[model samples]
Target chain A: MRTELTERFGIDYPIFGFTPSQEVAAAISRAGGMGVLGCVRFNEASELDEVLEWMHENTDGKPFGVDVVMPAKIPTEGSKVDLESMIPPEHRAFVERTLDDLGVPPLPDGNRVDAGVLGWLHSVARSHVDVAMAHARKYGQIKLIANALGSPPPDVIGVAHDNGVQVAALAGAKDHALHHVEARVDIVIAQGYEGGGHTGEVTSMVLWPELVDAVGDRAPVLAAGGVGSGRQMAAAIALGAQGVWMGTYWLTAAEYRLGATGDGPSTVQKALLAASSRDTVRRRIYSGKPARLLKTKWTDAWDAPGAPEPLPMPLQNLLVGEAHARISQADDAGVVAMPAGQIVGRLNSITPVAELIADLVSEYQESAARLGKTLD
Target chain B: MRTELTERFGIDYPIFGFTPSQEVAAAISRAGGMGVLGCVRFNEASELDEVLEWMHENTDGKPFGVDVVMPAKIPTEGSKVDLESMIPPEHRAFVERTLDDLGVPPLPDGNRVDAGVLGWLHSVARSHVDVAMAHARKYGQIKLIANALGSPPPDVIGVAHDNGVQVAALAGAKDHALHHVEARVDIVIAQGYEGGGHTGEVTSMVLWPELVDAVGDRAPVLAAGGVGSGRQMAAAIALGAQGVWMGTYWLTAAEYRLGATGDGPSTVQKALLAASSRDTVRRRIYSGKPARLLKTKWTDAWDAPGAPEPLPMPLQNLLVGEAHARISQADDAGVVAMPAGQIVGRLNSITPVAELIADLVSEYQESAARLGKTLD
Candidate 1:
């Protein structure tokens, strides 16, 4: 059956869908492949339990996975405090002044943004990973665990593998892949510069092959940078890859739990282009570490020239997370930006996961069929 | 102070460098630049005199150009014609006979390869451009030219342009102010993914602002491809551009004198990678398409299931094009490739001049750049 991977993962197809929404995870699993939930969104313990229970009831024992944010670098105690504490009052003053000059008027409607929004960005991130692990232990659908940023911590790895679950991590550079190997990650996702969110500066054509060369055939190599279509998936395999790991593709799926803010369609093109890597400021703005986000007014104000850099790890994310929440609820397009990949270029339209998967298989079949002629 | 290009082409920057010795034609004159001779080892034409002398003395005192073959694209074309081809027509016959036994070698190279040395690859390439143009007119340094392929087209552009000449062409990707552009081409260049001939498909990153952008109020933009580099160069100038236009970079450079001998470094890489799109291959093949190369016997053989792709452009280069003179002179690693665009990664590197220049800047820089970082 040329089923090496299917035999290993126990999925009908070798495809693996990655999404930030837990609901999307269940949907993909129900469709026959693997679906991984981005557990990073759930900030509290009880909230995670309820979500896991819901997934179990909905998916009816289908296999799925979870995603968490674990940055490569953790901030030191002195610098990892609340934004007001880590950043000098002078730095904070600069941000306010820049916004004032930009003519950013005070929020109308008695509150332009929730005052508590920017406070929980970090603790929630760390807790999300912990919570995912706990949920995996309680649920049968969780077969894998992934760290969104770098390699999962040894403890996280222990919990995953101890329970017979595979571990995967996202990486941009050759150096990062090396770290994952050291951490013994079961899969090394060599994402290219075309990938989204705080990506490394190397394009996939160059980076994927380089990683394959560097890693050899130790663990399966999943190409995950600019993949949005099946033809692209075929090209990745032709270049020597085990399978394709897709994330953004799932964002546009009908089952995606992305409740719209009423700005436009739930499509990447409409929402992503308006975003700048700056908008998705890579400050330790959210779950700590540098994360690319939509360049929101808050990110802009915080990132003005000569402004204090955001704090790191759990602390920095903790300080400003409340801001993320309130902004999402505020319906202000300027404050809410999707943490998407450069592959957003391919997210031209939205379709169901079933349709997308069928397209992948069909496109892949067509690519092979065309190449078959060259062989003849 | 000569300001090199100013004294030569009456413009700015000296970033001319490339394959196709004849590319100097429009490449030099249009930018108020110079051209050089790309004389290969076999360019023993004494008739070469009339060409250089005429150009030295004719052509509206405009800059001229020239170039030479730079080797690249390892495992070049000689393989099929080598002892491998010598495997006894009987062995080849037997292999052909047994094709039904194998499940189609799995890749293009396993299918079939064109045989024969790419006749008169470089010498004829360098000979005709500056030689023919110079022979046709007495343009002098104003008739400056470049050896689009190898080492300064044997000092012709410099010897004459020195007497008030201009020599210029295209560079691979990276740019240092005084390097080639700094050497003295009245204009500077910025080629991106949309360009042709031995390109790296880097988009405008290393192509535009890096070159056109790096100069800031300095130099002009001869943006090439998807360009013409123009929309982008126009955008580049928005980022900043001055003057812009580029042939298929190679085809446009040589001015149709290249006739179809397989040795023009301009399209070597295309002959290496077999896929017919920009994505199939991304590496430095012939003459350093560090941008992109055509798929061919040279590239395919190396990327084989168990084979190693060539080294960097410089290293792999030793095998393609002009090396065919030594096809029988040596082995399989020395011939069979050309330089073109990453688009050659899409198809052949050869193209028409109008189409080539059309993609570069054509009064489009201001709006394009404005769009890139537009405040609106």
Candidate 2:
């Protein structure tokens, strides 16, 4: 399964797994595929520094990356309070009424409503980039930085290159890939509408080839969205992608199957395992942008009639942050939401990261052999 | 690129091109790929029979197919008059106002408004099926019968199978493919959201692999949507598709570039040639269902504020049929609409069907070779 991407990232396999869990990320790296830790949940520079330090200590010198959500056009500017004020009262009232109707209880005493709203804003995301770059310079473990929303600014690309770290950006269209290439990013992850999180309407089969034909020679393109198996990995390579970027496939890894003390699967993990690909819906309830999330009462409420349109970006994230936090704290499966792709249908079991990687490699080999027979 | 599909269909390549033009369909079959003449525009059974007969005589012993749009769940069930009466007054006024605004003059001479309200209603489409089957039995030249909206009804499938004609249906989701297989479809064309005309939210890359994994062993799956290159064909095959079903690529073929007298491209063809992948929008302006079409004044008008939502299925088709005829007759580029896929970005030049098929084969070979190198 080695390709130009494996050589570029110095990994045994060219599978790039994106997740927020440090354990899952490190385990993926140890399993010979690059695990990219999402930094959007880190509120403070010190928190991100701690996560990076832990990853470095745990991965045994394997390559991993950091993902930051910095959209090219920030929805709002100035302080967090200013952005909060920009949200409409109707939207706020709808969210509150919806949460109340869902019968979600308030947090317990002494528990703060940790909405994790830090990296959603542009100013905080810039600070995240600074912290991650600084950690990369000091530890030399973070090999790549991926901007999830849009092309990284030229300065970020230049600084990452200067620090001996490569940069990647996710694009859902051919034009977006071209923009990333023009910005001089080292890699472009062509994500389709079927991908988890925020996505455009373009699907991976169409988006992958368009991105490859547009900028394959200029930069290595990593195929993302709806990719969950070895056959899909082989198909991505056949579509001219140097590698495959997977996110939803890792949510059910064994690391997430149980707590550190070995209790049982978390509420979110349980929901994912019990769900099918059709269980997810694309709505702007969690964030202002359309993101795929498990279809829960929270998402259904926002889509119902008389519900206000979601506020743009940071504002929407701000309005729903506390509701999400309360839902998570309550641990109610019917109301809890998780971002996932259409491939979630096939994610029926939890396995160790190493076993998953091995299965992927084996499946990829088998698929390639089958396709080879077609040519014969 | 000989696969089981090529052998099963007795064609030179595993490529199927769908178009409404008889000339383009015959040219595609003559060039080794199967040309499927879309029968949606033929209102009468005799008209379809005449066109099928013409295709039979001109294809030089090549195989061709007939495409019928009989949705599995018909929105309306009565006669065409009843369906026409079901259209709301506001929708009719809106269409009239939009067409008046676009400066599309009425048809010349004493030509009455031939709305051609044949394929939208269930009764008309049933008539179409009867005509196609009778023709198939008499001619023995039509090798395939494709249902665009859904799986062919059991009687249709049975009849086709009895006449030695294979039945194919288009699916945009995994469950849809399963349903088609349950209905005993011979082939499933898994189309993504990026495809032209009516499509579900699922994309081709995600949808293709899911469909293949679902029913590939039971029946052959043809990958559709955003497939305009040989590299994409190779990728689809790698994802487990037996062949590819293409539609938008044939819109700008040499057959469409010239009039019957070889004057110039039609207004619709010119619009397609000048369009980009991003220029298309999925709207219910023409049909009640959401379909991808070129973004023009007609589509944009319906998107404006206070515009009435389009009626369902046959009602919407009846309302817009005359307006479309007027716009096409006027040859106004701003108001003329045509169904297209996102791959329009790559359809910048027009070539003969033979040359296009040759290029696709060559590209498929090269892509397969490139993928083989990765496996090595």
Candidate 3:
């Protein structure tokens, strides 16, 4: 009856959902759980503000959270990330040709706005976080601040705690999980290999217990990666996890803003199968940051024998951003891949957000019942 | 460049392995491949001889095989199978008394074998195949036959193949791999799901492409489920396979066999950290048949409420023969519940057989290069 995270997150069930849409997030929270909005995709500042304002008017004051990226590596250090000039011309040419072949529109040749992953670094991520905070204050119910990439920098951590908002970060390994603990972070989310964005070798079943052991009594471990069903949620809890952090599951939720077509993660199972671990070819093709995704012709071209390699953070971000925007909206998906975790095999059908949450709880109850009898 | 098996089996490689040891028929004709033994902890006379002696002696003088079940799968086949009699009321009563108190066993008890599986279909597995065909006639060569339970069946498949004798087999999913296509049966084996005895399931990364997919392609596939070593091998190749089978990958190699101490699997990093997917669980009590192994005690009482009941065939075997053997051995393992498929974890160290075979072609090339590259 008394697990640390159950009370901390204020939920009857310790299931946390992450999504790129606000409606899905709010619904998960309103269903007696927590939902965090993924905040890195908005290309403009006003867009971020607009979404947050909408979230404020809609949530009816339920608890919610925001997520951003702060990877361990970056291209530059300064108040602003000037992404336009950092990428090489050859890379840009290749992307331009790919877009042309894809029949997607190119930006007008004129006054350049900051262009790639470098175009969306701490400056961009923080801008969205600022939007999250202003709106959280307006609504007075946002309960947490989470870093989707690496550790939350000291300043971000300090600010969130000051605002009575719990700060959380993602970790791919046991060592990284410890980094979260030593930093006094409220949660050290130990992710397994089957998660959506970035992940590591161990599976959720194997990693959950390891994290519980490593973080002993220090931080409540929020298990992330490879979770898409109620049985899985129950299994995680049976293995000692205090809560479950989920993202990929929400991609198919009805209220999410993503289009029904060409969302690589949506039709994932139909295309790929049988990789030892995953088609996790790390490329700075999106956000100019080295991210894992299903393999595609776009990645193969960069990895081809003679292609110019990817640049670091912001520069790669600058180089790939527009291309990301274009391809995501195009039909040549085989030529361009998208971010995904290995759990895609199980991401088969679509269901409503509230139904998904309710099913998970019911399944969790069933699994617990199964496990309890075995122990008894 | 030459090893005993290479010359004997007349193939480029001599690493023979498979799940069901009696698959001596299909394994032998798996051209240029070897079929070891396993899965016959509960074998019969006719079943073993037909496939081993009858089939092996007739297959274009090609090598054939047999294997045995050692550790892994707690609940072997039970009355669910067509046994002459169900595990006596006394046996069931004894099983109940043993499980009064215990949590997670010494393990998570990956997978368990039940006695109800074979359900008293008392037939000599390839073990009898190994035994009944003593001196059938000479053949191209019997690469090898191995076993997970006791030593060389009644007559190791090699003896029947004559002077150019060779044999091998491992446990775990070995049951699924034991069928001969066409060839003189030479080997019978058993490779545990765990790294020792019979095993399965836990170590997903270990590879034994030889057994899992050899049928119809010349020889038959050879697998010992919990094989451990390379990360990429986990991407097993059943590419052009008739069937894919496995067992845990741990054993009594020339240097590691026991010296009357009733040896258990090694605990080195290669074994311990291998992976549970290649491990096993204590299933049946052992002598009565369910495999005796190291694992969680969960499998011992699978009939608990709401637990999906296991079926027959191999299920009852877990609780019969092997369970009895463990109790007689008075090994504390009796309570640990023997079935094991997670043996791959103990497969940390490599022995001469498989390593030598995989390396043979490379070594042959190395030798050829020393002599110059154009021999072909």
Candidate 4:
């Protein structure tokens, strides 16, 4: 558990839990791993600041982090209304027809669906960084800032460094890992194709070793994707990764709630729990960039013949944002737009965050011993 | 290195080396690993019988195996001429145009192009099994018979068992593994998407554990795909596989000669040696089934717009078999139709087969020890 990642981050294990739920994030930090609260769901700065303050109060002084979706190439800087206006009419019509076909009704009265992915815009992401930096400066609880899209802008990295918070970025390929290192990012989360969210084509078994060889000397590499058990964690370490950065495995954690609406174990979680490793598909429908999502009726509809190609980032998210909102509210497992990994097959139960971490450690130890026995 | 596989097969290690070259297969057996010779390239029974005889003589009584491309369902049974006549004119024109664009010359005037994939037919694969069974009865060197496509027809499995040889089938999904076990295959090779030749969508990291949970009690699971080092092998064992089955890592072995014509270090080998993990594409261009290949000009041509959709199974193989022959003979690295895995990135050297096996063992031990230290 005490790799360079743990020592550098001052955490008990090299495990980094990614969740949008402050409850789960706080629970993970309390259980001795770094809890990274995803900030892309927060469009307003004050909403994120309140969550950070709540995280500060609930995490019992344990270290936590914030993840922002700052695309390396800033896309269309505009207000939410302007961005909504930019979405094509045909794309909106397609979404409406697909939602109608799926029978996912509109949100109930007074439930306003804002434009999707407001945080993906550069302006909103900047506000996210400002809020995270302010939290780091105020409570000293925020220890890291992770850029989900790519390497953060230089000014953002500088602000994070000035606040004494490490900056980390996720890379799916060797070239991207090298680029992150060249940009002086602190740590590289080498995510493979089986990972949840945006990923590259290489599977973790190959990509981890390739990336470790590419940037292990410069920055510690954490294996992401295809990780659901301690044996998998052992595999990551065996492949030369310093630790594991897991997101999907935390979805069914007992402490996890829907980040946007704070609902516990909704139909999305049910669908994810019932999935197999083969139940996920990689598509651009989730975020415009190809991300792994549960292969439900919603994804299948988008992939059907004659379906329009997904739009570019932010635009695509904007088009589907309201559809996603309606689906979430509908609680229909068949059409949920949930981001998950191939590891969804292994999430068969709900356990406390503390117990899950303990099990991971114990399983990791047993796996190491089993491997030793093989060599002997 | 002793696992259920090593114990059952009486091999020194749990490693199974797959290669199409008899020389390389013999070297793997001689080096204390079970070498599985690919039999799909042998179009004639006499050719396979002669190779099995040579394997018996060259293996020094070490355990070896034979792999045949016997799809679970039977395809058309016809003469090579009939199969050739079935390929459409448009497909032929496409191949010609693509090869011409790549600057690959036609074969010499006397050299004959094949109808392609004769061995994929049920008759050819049955002959391969018969030749292998004869070898098992005579010299006892053929310890196993593996079906590359799926669970071999029940009769093939029964015949192998009658000859006192074990049968192994490859599966990529939980349902496929369950079907194989239900059909009473002796061993299951859980191949992931990162594997060479034919593969499934699930990755080794996730597929291994899923297959193990599905059929480990009835059959031993051998992890295949994305394995280039002993560390990857250790990862497989830790994921509950009894051993590792690897093929791509052997492509550049000094002893590997092109099985078709016994050529050494051809342009195909050169291209594979130069590839990165990212330099592969999973396309139906190789065999009608989706297989990973070096992302060369040939594969790219097939993927280009206006290219005809690849034909199904033996027909597709038939359509492109002559093109493959010409490409192999022409020695054009840029357009070679080579079936490789994502692990091609690691095949940078042409070490002898014996040295490669040794490196794997030593690396496995080192990786196991490293995991042990992490746990400590």
The DockQ scores of all candidates, in the order shown, are 0.02, 0.59, 0.02, 0.79
Residue-level lDDT of model 2, residues B1-376, one tens digit each, is: 5788999988888899999889889999998899999888878888888888898899998889988888777754577676778888888888878878889876676464645556766767788788878878887878899988878789989988998899999988888889999999989999888888888777777778889888958899998988998888887888888899999998888886422234677777778878877788888877788898888888888889989998777677888888877877777677777788888877877788888888888888877777777766
- Give the range where candidate 2 chain B is weakest over 10 consecutive residues by summed lDDT: B256-265
What's chain A's TM-score in each predicted model? Answer: 0.80, 0.96, 0.85, 0.96
Tell me candidate 2's fraction of native contacts, as a decimal between 0 and 1: 0.61
lDDT over C-alpha atoms for residue B231 of model 3: 13
> Local error of candidate 1 at A150, Å?
2.7
- Indicate the residue-level lDDT of A70 in model 3: 69
Chain A accuracy of model 3 expressed as TM-score? 0.85
- Which has the better lDDT: candidate 1, or candidate 2? 2
Candidate 2 wrong stretches, greater than 4 Å = A75-77, A110-114, A257-262, B75-77, B109-112, B257-262
Q: Per-prediction TM-score, please?
A: 0.51, 0.95, 0.54, 0.97
Best by lDDT: 4
Per TM-score, the best of the predicted structures is 4
Instruction: After the best TM-score superposition of candidate 3, give how far the Cα of residue B104 lies from its true spot, in angstroms.
Output: 42
Q: Per-residue alpha-carbon lDDT of model 2 for A105-132, expressed as tens digits?
A: 8777746454578678777778878888
- Compare candidates 1 and 3 on TM-score and give the better one: 3
The candidate that wins on DockQ is 4
RMSD in Å for model 4:
2.0
Give per-residue CA lDDT, model 4, range B1-376, as digits (tens). Answer: 8888888988898989888899999999999999999988888999999988888899888999999888866454778787778888999999989888898888888566553478778788888888899889998778888888878888888989999999998998999889999998999999999888889999999999889988859999999999889889989988889999999998999888773345557687889888989999999888889998889989989888999999878788888888888888786678888889999999988899989999999989988887877756
Output the worst ten-in-a-row residue range by lDDT, candidate 2 chain A.
Answer: A256-265
